[model samples]
Target: MASPHRSDDLHQGDPVEDPPASYEPVNSDDALPYDDYEAEHRPPPTLRLRLAPWDVISTALLLTLLVVLATATNWPWRLYGFLSDVCTGETCGLVPFGVDNYIYPVVWGGIGAAIAAAGVGPFVSLLKGWYMSFWPVLSLTILMVSSVVGDSLTLFSERYWH
Candidate 1:
């Protein structure tokens, strides 16, 4: 026969068992001695305002490299030139001719701003001791790839379309 009160039964009216005579009860009001000792000895967390000089210097150099690449490849100008060359006369009449003169600068400015914003996160992380050499390298690689892609497109259009 099954017992009336199963071990698993936890009803609220069930009688509570007293603790063993050997068990010592801890008073909630008493604080552990080590708690005070640990609090006194432990160093308080500090906020550091110091900037990492090397990361800043490297980021500056990276920015300089980006500027040099932009100037050398004429990134925005090349893109404008490509668009001007491709969209001419009746073939691309839907878009107003020479509209790129006004639009490209704004478009390229947005792209440049986005790239600069993207670089900021990695630069900050680098300063905060996070390992991030990949960002600068990736930026340079993107510039190189864009330059190559622009040149290739220009060549392809000139050879096949013209």
Candidate 2:
């Protein structure tokens, strides 16, 4: 049976954290146990996203990349299409926009990837208890795939499908 719990785990330690005198599980119809409350608000069910150190770092990285991409996609260099069009005999870096385009996309992509690997990936692992399954890698892959394919999909939809 799913174990009943006290709502005191929020204090961090043991499964049973109620006051010694009053730590009894609710009498079926009275006050609920601490575990019940915890289960109700658990970060997320197992095999799901879990916040972790990498998540924090990756989130920061993604945010930074977002900033860089936004910055480069504008004026002066217009680096949005830089890396995408690089070495393709097309005007990627300094032609359509400028020199900023050449380096901006790559930098932003790196940041985006890092954010996925570090932030989103780890959080998945954390939620799934990293050891329970392959959450870390799986989560990272999900984000990586999204970032990589998202660009192409956006372009295709806008240019061809739409």
Candidate 3:
């Protein structure tokens, strides 16, 4: 014979008490009286733009520095040359690009700014999750691409425009 106090016996055919009629669902998690939510009731917007403002600014500044470097201005080369003298006795290569000029310090300044901005991004709530990883990579890519493009433009201008 089966035991009356068995674990399954207690709930197998037990009657459940109905929820109190006075209780109304106040929160969104509770079942809604309506069939479904519509587009008008969609969730709040997220920050989804591919490039953030800071990334653009940093890339632009770096490209601008490249343009300045291509010029005949001797000050940038002299300054960077003086700074590089302490280390290798040669003018520091500001970027991997072959052109070396006063733009070295300015290029370095823009890179430092990008790094600092990327570092500070995590503290922001929206930037804490996926954005934290995405932003730094994007910033670096933008800077690198801008540098290459600037170099190409410089070469083109010298070859044809002059």
lDDT of each: 0.52, 0.47, 0.46
Kindly indicate the candidate among 1 and 2 with the higher lDDT: 1
**Residue-level lDDT tens digits of model 2 in 32-143:** 6677875665545335445466555655565555546546655214323333533333432233334333344545555566455544554454565553223334434544
- Any residue pairs clashing in model 1, and if so which? none
Better of 1 and 3 by TM-score: 1
Would you estimate the TM-scores of all the predictions?
A: 0.39, 0.23, 0.28
Tens-digit lDDT track for model 3 on 120-142?
55445244333344455554654
Sorted by lDDT (best first), the order is: 1, 2, 3
Worst 10 residues of 1 by lDDT: 92-101
Native-vs-model 3 lDDT? 0.46
Model 2 — which ten-residue stretch has the worst lDDT? 153-162
